[model samples]
Target: MKFKTIVVVNDFSFVNGGAGQVAISSAIGLLAKGYRVILFTAVGPVDENLAKQGIEVVCLNQYDILHDPNRMRAIIQGVWNVKAKVVFEKLLRTLNRTETIIHFHAWSKGLSSSLFSVTKKQGFKTVVTLHDFFLYCPNGGFYDYPHNKICTKNPLGLSCIFCNCDARGYIQKIWRCIRQVIQNKMLYQIDGTLFLSISDLSTSIFKKYYPNKKALLFRVNNPVALLPLFERIHVENNNAYLFVARLSLEKGIDLFCEAVSQLGLEGYVLGDGYLLDTYKKKYPMIKFIGWVTGVEKENYIKMAKAFIFPSKWYETFGLSVAEMQSCGIPCIVPDKNAAAEQIIDGETGFIFQIGSLESLKDKIVCMEKMKMEDLARMSQQAFEYSLRENYSMETHLENITKLYDSNF
Candidate 1:
């Protein structure tokens, strides 16, 4: 029952974020490994790489919930997406179920849980990549957005349902809760499905919410393309601390801003989000370079003293933290979530007390005052550790292919 075909499912065809990047990259890798691959997405002007690599793509050509102009339609489609269900079902019917694996990477942004019903009705084996906690938490991140902290309430329970946790408002929170209820129902209907976790911390957090006795889950490292050792960023000589993520509340942008401002140190933010204008007005001291990709983005990362990943929630895997470390630039992460797991604390990078500005400032000051010799040593260790543990595409492909084959 080895899988010969993989239908890679995500909300977007382009690399909109981490999940889309993983879905597209892995689909390409799977094709190179001789498996027939198809990209099934809800949003696109499809990425050129997929077509260039000869991978088949089936796109819905739609907008994600947040960006959709029609509010009512986005809300409805975010819950069930009848069109996606029908079209995806038509696609599945043409394939031999036993030979195809539905590798679902993301959905909450657009496609919704209806895709699950499609796979269930068609009797196809599926592997869900735990890119985030949307399968359990209503808002994807188990975060109290307004309060700017990690949430402990049981998801969808009375306490969880009553919390006004959505970034938009309480009404949106309730709507997302309704969406989660249907998604959970569709999730629990399938049996013998595999949940692919990207980090041990992500695996642990997921296990807490999904304690169903029948659930199957395991950790699989996300493939990080290690940078060439010769191309290492001379971060030890840099003076500015860097923060790269959506300028959102749960990401702890406020914490980064306050910490760097209070210390009067140079700080730079590399990404953009809805909070950009507000952050610019509030923290004029911190430089906010609007979202830039490719060479421009890498150039910003290269000028960093250290990456400040002050995520307030339990991250599934802070891909940027891993990328920074892999590039021989240490990251300063809070002592919570998967970002901390990527660092060797005090060696590769420092881990501050979660949500404590004082703790974060202490680490930043430590990094700021460190001798050049010590900082260089830390960079060297970060690069060496990445090579040993955080593997590249080849190893990632091998591990994933084994999972696909063995699951059958």
Candidate 2:
């Protein structure tokens, strides 16, 4: 079953972050199956790689509204004008109805929520992959601003004030609240919604918020095409620990820094973020290598004794943790969130209590005393687990195809 006129909507045309990369890869996979994919984004400077792969790119002119200084005014203009809806509808009109599927990935940046309504009204089957919490939360990740703490309450609840979660402004929050109300009304209009993680905890959260929606939900894990170069292998002696992710607050980088500083262990940071300058100054002992990609990322993972993931929020999935495990390096993740599902504590790596520096410090101290052979064994277990249960590109494609096929 070939979807000859498939449209993929996202924030960017190129694969940069995890969602961007997933979007590009999914398009490539679809193209390989002889599906004609039209990659749409609000902004472009299309990914050179996607162009090289022969995927068509479409940029919506409505993206400029996001750059406006008065964000609330811009959002008001965006919601009423339905610029994104018009653009998407115009494109859909050109395609044969039977051969098309509108697959939306991310819509927070510039694309207004009205696009979904327009598509549904046109009788087009739509599939929306839940890459993050943007559809339900104003801030996208359901993370509180400044503090970067996770909000557990249902976004639609009456008592749910948007103050802490609103990154734009009070007026913008009002705009978002109005937008979310519209989105909730249009929730059942979608043909399917795909979640990448299968944790029962996450499923329960989704169920609570979207109880009345009849949309089909499927658990399809993201695929890693290449075996990450850092797959755990037996190392005679390993001393450096690695942290590979955006150095953001919700990622618990501050907690990791504090714990490592207290433990006095030698560690390396392989990412860049807003907290870099502050953390660097505060902890002079730890090495910060900024951002890395390709072979450079692999080299860092290969050299690291273990990976540290101390995230305090409910991660939909931990790609870095899986990548590190693939490298044969054990991980020390917080017991909270999806890391608990990813890391087999004591067998593959250790799981410390969430947000507790003392728990993390104790785990680091315990790991520090382990024999090199024992560490290597744990790394082997991590590698075996990732290979057996995760890391398959085929699995992701098959699951996604099932969702698409089932709807048709």
Candidate 3:
């Protein structure tokens, strides 16, 4: 039960949003429990925050592979890089075989699908956490290409054509298809797969395609770590709604902006994205605060009347929803996907019909009529509900340690 070394592989450094935060939190939790945790990432002049936390970060650039224009070359480097594979192998050889477990978060960006192939061939027990739909979908978001619409088509269907979901055109789609094939093959070698939310509708779609795999399935919803709650300072602002997610089409920000414009209400946006400039020009009244973190993020959550979560795709888990709930902020989310699991309609928060601008507008109008006391009560319920359902780092660490102990 005493694990001396634990290796976590992710796509990016931990200073970025949600996925990186998850990686850092889990690494910190494991380190606290006496594991020598090492993080393997593709590119990093290591994030100072992660370095300060005492976690060792290994970048893949130590390998002699130069960046390539061909997508296949990058994929090959991820799988067959002698230096990166040797670094991992050296760590494994130094540890007791029975006491080491490789926990992989993501391998999409730099580490190719073949990293899992190396781990499995070395006879190392491995676990992968599903962060997005990239494991099966070539686009990673289960969104149709060019149009940016939600795609419900089964990936294994013969009619499954690349939608060019990344907006990079036909060549990109072809490369993504190749990546998908590589990923599916590598997954067969993994010992277990963990989902952050139980409401993984896309994962269910994946199951129908590959029903014979013996991977152990575990759902440990992402933890919400927030600043300490303070006394409610109810600000009387009826027009103050908040949107705190990446400003992308799939996030339904376009619909949200249109709805707000129809309502003639001004709101605040707390993140930036590819659509930021476009939306800013279109809606001059709404405030864009461009990526607030820590105290700034905390205050924004506290000041908002209600947070809007208008995502169209099946999000793995709404990390922003959990963060809002922690700060006693109610959210108006769509009825489908993981948002349905997180929100208690008319109680903790409200649920609008998915992909309907009219329904979203109706919900916003309904919120305008609610008494401040009722909203306050709902906020309290939201905060309490989050504390009950979402795991804390301490609890998650204990659960994962138990899983490793019992399974290994």
Q: Pick the candidate with the highest lDDT.
A: 1
- Models 1 onward score TM values of 0.96, 0.91, 0.90
Residue 341, candidate 1: Cα error in Å is: 0.5
Clashes of 2: 6
Candidate 2 local lDDT, 1-408, one digit each (tens): 855677887877766577777888888888877889889787666788788889988876444457858766576655544666777788888888777888888766666667777777777767776667666765566666555677766675665554646655666667777777777677565555444334544565566666554546666777765544543455437677777778877888887888777877778898998889988998899999999888787776666788889887777677778777776778899875776788888989999987787988888887888887788788788888887885576678778777677657
Instruction: Report, for every candidate in turn, its global Cα lDDT versus the true structure.
Output: 0.87, 0.73, 0.73
lDDT tens digits by residue: candidate 3, 82-153: 455666666666666676778888776666666766777677767666777776777777777477567777
lDDT of 1 at 308: 91
Distance from true position, residue 272, model 3, in Å?
0.9
Q: How far is candidate 1 from the true structure (C-alpha RMSD, Å)?
A: 1.6
Question: In candidate 3, which residue ranges exceed 4 Å CA deviation?
Answer: 62-83, 162-164, 191-206, 230-238
Q: If both were scored by TM-score, which would come out higher, candidate 1 or candidate 3? A: 1
- Deviation (Å) of 32 in candidate 3: 1.0
Please give, for residues 1-408, the per-residue lDDT of candidate 1 as tens digits. Answer: 288899999999899888887899989999998899999999988999999999999999988988999999998999989889989999999999979999999988889999998888888998999998897889888898788888889999999999998888999999999998898889889888998899887888777788585577867888865444445678778888889889887788989999999999898998888899999999998999988777787777778888899988888888888778777888899876888888888999999988888999999899888899899889888877776784687888888788878866
